[model samples]
Target: MDLLRYVAFTDDPSGGNPAGVVLDAEHLDEPTMQATAAEVGFSETAFVVPRGGGRLDVRYFSPLAEVPFCGHATIATAVAHAHRHGVGELLLNTLAGEIAVSTSASPDGTVGATLVSVPPRTEPLADGDLAELLAALRWSAADLDPELPPRVAYAGAWHPVVAAATRARLAELDYDYDALATLMQRHGWTTVDLVHRESPTLFHARNPFPPGGVVEDPATGAAAAALGGYLRELGLAPAVLTVHQGYDLGRPSTITVTIPQAPGTGIAVTGTAVPYES
Candidate 1:
């Protein structure tokens, strides 16, 4: 029943996205898990139920509600598992799908985890929905990137992939939290994946998860995996991708996304993690 805190996607605990990692939740119920997650007050708290057959049932809960999947929490959980059992592979049954997680130890004694996401799909943004979303964020059509269309992408969870034409535009993140949260709740979206592509392989990203009661997420590996799928689906990229996030928050974290052009193959997101002192 111990609650461990760890930050994923950065070797330094103070750098990456913080997540509550509970390695064993065998004796906990849904209510208790939710309360625990709320008490932890992270964007997401992962509860790992170690079942038989070398598989663990993973559930993610934010301070407000449950989510389909959470990448930072998954990375934190994998690192916690490695700290106890050693670096290796793990089978996780999440609300989204079956995720395969592999862990490796770095030279600096940091534990990293790579999780393959479910096959991704995208849908055109509804006209009305787009208007509402723009209003919620106070962003107009001119503020978007013509190269990256506004569409809803799904890897494990659904996210609106909105690309800013300029870095300055992405940095000025002022939005109505309640309005966005309402819209996201109605659409079942995990977050809005705000992105700015710097080059062919490098990119910057920010995730606004108002529905989860968070202003912005520093690092979002799941959203990066979904972005990789979206890019490949739209013929934006053919191979691997690198996502740089949290720079705006001053706690930069890197997420490497591996893309394969299979019909229904999962996307892999890799990042390093470390335990939090406080």
Candidate 2:
């Protein structure tokens, strides 16, 4: 099996989240896939088994366990497929649901991919859960932004949307790993989507991914989609919004989230990717 490495959400190899891609994993079993992902040691690794007719069965595995879906790995896989097979549309069968991905190239020859998530939904964060979450993150209730209330959002995976009132609060991310992991595991949360709205059309984000056995994720596609859904559902989203993430991690990445006017629809996330030698 050929293991490919690529960074999603940025054209530069050193500026985005790295993912492992196995484009042809037709014979690998679950144990092998899990071991491979663990060995790869990125946030997630994508294993694809072609089903023909532009359809593929895709599985995402992190170092510790398998996940329903992964945004950055999906982008990396799509871009890798485009480089090898050609840019077009693909129907991905994931554990979460069927995801539609499209690949295109820019004038400067950068390959980009856009994945439309499954219909997103949100649930109010229970008061008890909120207290536990804040305690784990070492954040106080007063640090939260009133405009963007806390919610558990789901696009393909579940994420708790926690909005910081100020950028400074968002930057200070020293959370208790074990406590947060336990809380997230109990709630079945994929990540804690910590965000700060810079403007109507721009935002800053940081994701705590203890569930994935990682301290944080630089550019989280799944959480971004969930956040878009949360904003749209709350009537706070613009038609187009830009998310700046990974700045504090020093691997700055950009994610573009597009919210359709119609309610109860999928959200679109677009970003460029590049192959990296690993």
Each prediction's whole-model lDDT (CA): 0.90, 0.95
Residue-by-residue lDDT tens digits, candidate 1, 1-278: 98899999998867989999888899899999999988999899999999865589999999999999999999999999899888989999999999999999978788899999988888998989998998888899999999999999999999999998988988998998999999999999999999998887888998999988899999998899889988988888758888989998988899999998885789999998888755
Per-residue lDDT of candidate 2, residues 1-278 (tens digit) = 99999999999888889999999999999999999999998999999999998899999999988999999999999999999999999999999999999999999999999999999999999999999999999999999999889999999999999999999999999999999999999989998999999999999999998888989998999999998999999999999999999999988899999999788899999999998644
- Stretches of model 1 off by over 4 angstroms after superposition: none
Please provide TM-scores, in order, for all candidate models, with all chains considered together.
0.97, 0.99
**Model 1: lDDT to the true structure:** 0.90
User: Model 2: residues >4 Å from true position, as ranges?
Assistant: none
> Highest lDDT: which candidate?
2
Q: Which residue window of length 10 is worst by lDDT in model 1?
A: 233-242
